[model samples]
Target: MKRSKALKVETMFNNFKLTFFLQPLHGLPETLSDTANANWPWQQDINWFLALAEFKRLTQQPTLHFFLLEVWSEHTRCLALPLCSTKDGRYWSSLTDVYSPSFNIISSTTLIIANPWQCLLHALTQLQPNWVYCQLSPLRQEQIQQLTKLNGCLRTHVFEHSENWLANCSSNQEYWHKRPGQLKNTIKRKRAKLLSSGSRIEIHSQLTDELMLKYWQVYQQSWKQPETDRYFINWLANYSAANGMLRLGLLFIDEQPVACQLWLVHHSKAAIYKLAQDQAFDNLSPGTVLMADMVNYVIDIDKVTSIDFLTGNDNYKAMWMDFNFKLYGAELFNINSLTGRWLWSKQWLKTTLKTIARQMHHLIFRARHDN
Candidate 1:
């Protein structure tokens, strides 16, 4: 059965009436795939969210409740954000930092109203989600301020989430040339070594059970953390392949797959979603060899305009990317609740303790130097 917040229950302010409801994931909205509002349909579309939600339900926690959070004013929709949380609405996050590339909210009008963000605050006043409310992450700094100021919720906190890397592709040759000399030499040496050691390499735009099996085997052999939702990547592979955006690369040494990468190419942009290199092949740099080849293919053959390294500020990502961007998020809790106050107090106490410890360490060091 589909569950919705009661239609009669509404919030009215500034001549605008808001009627929002929590909808389940079983009925994903069609507007989720609207490309007009998305930068990457592959990641922003309904399929991606469904895959993530279903993976959570099947692998991690109890059943998750998805809400189609929409705001309306006399029939005109003002804001639409897809939200997922526990049935009780606690411990919620708008986007999975690992899986999602970006955050999105859609509406015919702006979210400048007084009550757009108060939806959660209202619930808290009525004591719906009592603690550890929701986090909306990877938002722009401006967006963070706007949402925090507009929401009546008192326990709102803004956090810097990640440092991500990206590059604007012009030509594969130029891209290679622009890279550091040391990286270029490393790639050259690794490619020569792999080729001399009898390596088989290929990039596939199609998805097959056999190829996925090889990827899983490589993942197990590689340094990646073990997956709880084993079929999550398989679902992504199937979807990306069917859309002709799949870019799977693998390198095998002595008939054994040692390294693999999964990239998605859509709308003239290529995103490096996942990659793995077996620890055994770390000396040979199989991961680097395979990545260079696929990057070349996506740039020279697929003609992508940009390449996204996706989530992370890893030392390796900065080596290849032309620039980096900061991602921010907002954590919202109702200060009216005791749990909320405790949470804020705990943060303040922690910060104060760190400051005191640092000051003592500095003074002690000065005294030691004088002695």
Candidate 2:
């Protein structure tokens, strides 16, 4: 029987049946809330997927086709793969967005499932014969390495996305001391100037209804690009505020809102989610001053272990968050499809050429060193 793009796979992986459920966790035989292998509950649990579904709905984004691939050994489930296919049904991805910090696939660490990655690929290949690509992203280096190393697909390629920045806060004094002198001097000068110019500035932390109104007002006047979904940011602020994770900071100049930043604190880590500052306040450097104060607040007041400047490799980010972890993504290609085949070959050739170039450079370096 010919299968459609939304076809399900019921393949056997060494006797373990790989079943794809059309619904979310409700379709699963058992909840993975208490799964023994769940290290990162936020990323791996059933609730996270449900939240993503709700987020999409609330944001009015196109609904994705959710897939719950459960691997069962006899009647006991070994692992579950939570996946979301795009509206076009050609690409498979995680239930993640720009806001999602990371992604994960729950698997039993104790279970000796030989070549589970291969089984996953086989099942996907059979289910979506015309599948062009797959991407699971915002993953750490270890996570990316695991997928690429265990990959059974010949055309899978790994790509570095960004250098996610982090600030280790031993203390406010220590953290500030390590900062570049130029940064400190600029903030000091700009802040003093703003104050002396009779521009009374105030920074607020609460996401109250009044503050929320001021936030959107200033954000519109800011230099930052417009958000694709404006409602999602507002929703995120409310959600984070309810969870006591919202650290939405608004900077005002004489009662007029000039700058606003969206930050979230959770699990003893503070993330700099979003920030916007009015271009009219560029001379005052409200962004820089606000950031400095926020940093001090997160460390001395909030007592967060670390401050994450998530999802950017901006030059200024390096000055504040000195330490960084590289985030990566992988592209999986199907050799059976013509477009996929070309993509695979091109990627292969690019990789091989890079390898050759590096080897040649190494050889030349060695000969030069001998001289």
Candidate 3:
């Protein structure tokens, strides 16, 4: 069946005589609320915040199809997947927006399906999303294996691998002892030097709109690029204030803000949202000092079980994180669609050219070194 570009796409899929409902975020199954609240973090509220923030962009001014799926089967709701289909029905993909790093498949504890991958594949067919792709960071070996054997009708590709860092903290003393001795001493030394110079350091945990503006002001002084999502951040700040989920940390030096971080606390987990440090205070290591203090607060005061540094595995993150996980990208294409077939061919050709170019570069470098 072909879809008209103007009509809204909503339907149900069937496999093994069981129907699976594919609905938008608003049409989630009644049982999902308890499951989501128990299994996921505050960030998973992507339905309300992230989706809303990107709705207009994804829809292309009301000319495209955009929906985050909440899939339900006969007995129970299995998972929620992010999906975006273009107006022409020619382009469709898994949602991997800039703001969210992990397009994770959150499952309910009630899931009892024998072959989840097969069921998911059948459900996906109903949407006719020509191409479905997502980056699964830190996926388990078993999950990747299941995805590989999803179905013979679809071609699946595992594109890349990356890493994410996370810190597991139980207490202040434990966290302090886990870090390298050199790091501990350096932070202490910096703190002492700043104090001796009459510079005071303060931590701000609550973020009112007024305080967020102060953070934005200090962020402007930082070395990072101009924030493209200030509006989104402001929206998040407002949501967080009413819910009491915000943990905005600012390192002030004698009444001037130098470094800041925004963390969202949900139950026992705290995820770092955004952080910035003034380049002028680089020598003072305001960012590092601020991080150390925040770590202490997260562990000692908040008593959170874990702190996810989120998507990146930078040198600084490695220094602080006790462990790391791998991230992978997967793309699945439907063989039935002519557009899908054409896109797959173009993708293969592009990949081939890149591979050949890399090989040529390697050979040239080798020859130059020999000469």
TM-score of each: 0.83, 0.77, 0.79
Backbone clash pairs for candidate 3 read: 137-327, 138-326
1 versus 3: better TM-score goes to = 1
lDDT (0 to 1) per candidate: 0.73, 0.71, 0.64
Q: Pick the TM-score winner.
A: 1
Q: How accurate is candidate 2 locally (lDDT)?
A: 0.71
Poorest lDDT segment (10 consecutive residues) of candidate 3: 24-33
- Tell me the number of clashing residue pairs for each predicted model: 0, 0, 2
Candidate 1: tens digits of C-alpha lDDT, residues 34-63: 442355653346566666667766777556
Best by lDDT: 1
**How many Å off is the CA of 59 in candidate 2?**
8.4
- Residue-wise C-alpha lDDT for candidate 3, range 1-371, written one tens digit per residue: 23322212334334334444444432212212343354333335543424443544533334545554555655655666555556454455555544565655656656556666666656666554554332333344566777778766666666655666888878878777788988988899988876765665555555566788778988999988886556556655655545556778877777788888888776787788788888888898877877888888777777898888877667877778789877666666666777656656777788889999999999999999999
- Give the distance in Å from residue 328's predicted Cα in candidate 1 to where it truly belongs: 3.6
Ranked candidates, highest TM-score first? 1, 3, 2
lDDT of 2 by residue, 223-257 (tens): 87776566556656665665566787767777788
Worst 10 residues of 2 by lDDT: 23-32
After superposition, candidate 2 runs with Cα above 4 Å error: 1-19, 22-82, 86-88, 106-130, 151-154, 197-206, 336-339, 353-371
Cα TM-score of candidate 2: 0.77
